[model samples]
Target: MDVTSDEVEMETAPVSADELVEAMRQAADDAGFDLEPEQLEVARRLGSLAVGEASVPAHLYLWGAAGRGKTWLLDAYFQALPTERKRRVHFHSFFRALHRSIHEHRTAAAEAARATGEPGAGARAAAGAVANAVDRAVEDLLDEVDLVLFDEFHVHDPGDGTLMIRLLEALFSRDVSLITSSNYPPSGLLPDPVYHHIFEPGIAVIEANMTVVELAGDTDHRRSSAVQRRQGFSRGTWMLTGQEADDELADLGLPRPDAADAVTMAISGHEFRASAARGGVLWFTSAELLERPTSVGDYLAWAAEYDRWVLDALPAPEHLTREARARFVHLIDALCDLDVELHVIAATDRETFMTAETLGRGGFARDAFRTRSRLALLRTVG
Candidate 1:
């Protein structure tokens, strides 16, 4: 266990399919998950296909409920592969990168058109530039990468769904293999009946080209007993004087403020500040602590940098309108995705306010309320 840096590097070898599956099993066991036989079989088959000689298919879809090890399986498989052969990214980050690439391509194309005698060619040039950018991004992503693993692959907007289709079409043409995990199957994605047709072709391609695996089990490995222990509870209030808190933060290896107005701290690699509170509360909101659309790297950084977080407020379920509540719920869900411990020292006990009746009154079903309550408990206490 005491692996030196050199020894650690030496120990890292390309993981075989069997090794990958075994590692998944071990991780499941460690997290107190009881894998069903079917789940195990899927893992074995996925490992085999991933390591097989055949060129990877256009797509591979693994869909199941939250905490069913869909993400875990894909992550384990990706980690097992040779580093150069894989790129694991959340769908949002990938889309943002793709969008930026498209923008750059369009800008270049515009510049080129401006320099040439081509009038009215700007639009066509821009379109071609976008296509090329998409192609190049897909190519770079697929370059040397035998498999691409995308986690939380869900389309909430029409624009995103269209972009996904185009991206997949390009990747498929190039024969780049894709493995994606989602809460719902391809057909169920973007559940609006109106836009279902738009998503149909993409879903058909996914179904035809990729093996569908479902790990239908009640146990959420992320919330398993062992994981709970590792994550620890987020509770208690650290009531220290302004100066005391500042000094303690420095002692704990966090940034200390020499002036009260400006407080500098880094969360997930992006540095931002909470204007020092006039009351010396130095309150932290989940929004302030977790910038929206955070990356896995950012999550890891936040987890390592802060063992315990003191928050003055958490967005309450009742205070938000339906859409707003859903967004906040999604945000909390994302926080759980990061697995960071949160310690809330709020003025009000928001925990007690999340009740079945309150949720019912708020227009949420009892079961939905219960699920959200459980997740909230995990966020508040875990």
Candidate 2:
């Protein structure tokens, strides 16, 4: 566990992944996580990877149940790594960016072919141009990062699955080291029966390029029975409709979100315009946060960075479309996972909010239940 300054500062020298994991474990323990025995063993395996002790594959792919600390471990490992050219990304956001890049590249390639008087350069030239564009995009995007780590890896879109094959090939060819955490095994990716084959090649790439490590566990540590009561969940009696909610927030020393100005946030190259953000506290209306096509990855990124969040005009699930409600569930899950202090201005009293007619409506019903549970812990302020 006693890593020297040289080990921590190994400029251009490769440090064993086990050493990084060991350091990460110590840091997590110091920060109060009860280090499970299996977690330590897995860290050792990951460290073995950093040192080339593993013979088959060099990259790492860790998978387990939700809330099993796969993200937590990757976070720690990413922080502990001394490598300067390392990047950590939420997998969903990464794919979103990748999709955009692919489109942009294909468009540019088409434009280039047209400029050369080959508007009908035919399929072969067009294909060659696209391939070159993909190469350029990948090179430019990852020009700075030698190691790329992805959290919450999943393949739900067939488009993303197809793109993954090319992206992974490019990264592997460049010898970019990889570390990923996922809920599903590579074989379990894109479980949609109809379009799963689109990702088969991508899955094969993962199998060939990474050493899959399973972190088996049952309990979700984030929601453990013995979870320590945390600060920052607060509620009020009055519906968060008018001036009353502002008064309540002022009483709790939080900013008045209505009067506060808006700020734009760019996550994974996508623009997210927030209604109010101040002093590391971000504020949003229910519509702004949920009605849009926001994913948990965006929330996760924000939660990791911001210490406080204020969500005003949080509507009951009944008031929202199914998609909006599902997104709300995802937001709560990310906040709980990161243990971020959340201040909400709910439309109704705490009890009514939990028992709304739309409570158990969607595929996210379980997430809704957990969100309600976490919300219950918030202090009622009015």
Candidate 3:
């Protein structure tokens, strides 16, 4: 089926639910996803939602293993939805922007409280200010957005569980519908036993308000796939550090920094050690990146500034601190989301680098599954 841009735009203009399913089928083909039975079921359900079918729930929570096509199905359907009032956000950048905006609102609110010239005014206003900050931030972030698609959603961090609850509440209050994909089911989120109970209320809201579906397929699709694209992360490679990796870098005419080329640069109020910038390429060792407290926002900032990134001297995952391992996962996530070219050099094979023992505790197991799947797109040199 040859779909013209005009036809796509026409489809987007308030199609019937039946017509929208046809549009969604076209979207799946365009996205190059082989629609499994489970995926098709979810996609059809999501398509039915474009027209707000009365029988359809207001929100959807699709959960599955990383390679089960949860993200692909949701994204493809989102593109085909017949509405301009929709927003799609990746979890990392979405949370980063949310945190930043809430902080900005709270600062302004606190300043106003201070200027009132009343004793304990700032202290007294802090509670209400937080609520206002959340409301204002959500209002700004989701202006006229009736539908939101949240990709790669997870609440692994204990500290973030509360934040997620607040965000869900805000979205509910505004009557904004949501479609989200996640590696874990609602009960499996924030898997830290100590903090699991704290998210129960949030889970209850989801259970009450959203339709939950599991896309359970046997295949690890990413692991079985080969690189078919010449741009973006698909064009990248994973290789053991050696002359072979260096030769490929030279063949691609990409930058590879020597010790003398490394330098420290400040970005987004955080310092990062990188190779001397060459055109749009930047290089850093795993230690320089993962050993520090660099945030997902910092990775996003760097990925934005540099089109290509080279990561070298990646140690075994077992050797790194849990924090460092988590940082690497976030780094891969940000880079993959932006489709930034990344060349990673590791000391061992991907399997050995991501052993069960290496991933340790918390929600790292599932999160690592996602990171590993993304890396599987990279060309591997044994």
Best by TM-score: 3
User: Quick one: ranking by lDDT, best first?
Assistant: 3, 2, 1
Residue-wise C-alpha lDDT for candidate 3, range 1-382, written one tens digit per residue: 1101111121336666666567667776776765778877877777667334344437889999878887777766776676676777767776776667656666776778899998877766765666676676567656756677777778877667878888888787666788888888898888778789988888898888788889988887888866566689878889898889888888888746777877787966778887656678878878888897788878876776888888889987777888888888888888987789989889988767876564556525757678888888888885
- Candidate ranking (TM-score, best to worst): 3, 2, 1
Q: What lDDT would each prediction earn against the true structure?
A: 0.56, 0.66, 0.75
Quickly count the clashes in candidate 3. Answer: 0
Deviating ranges (above 4 Å) for candidate 3? 1-12, 30-34, 50-57, 111-128, 356-366
lDDT of 2 by residue, 121-215 (tens): 54455567556656765675466565677666776668667767787898777656778887788998887779988899889999987888999
What ranges in model 1 sit over 4 Å off? Answer: 1-20, 27-34, 50-52, 55-59, 81-84, 111-121, 221-312, 333-382
Q: Candidate 2: give its CA RMSD in angstroms.
A: 6.7
Candidates in order, TM-scores: namely: 0.67, 0.68, 0.88
Model 1 quality (TM-score): 0.67
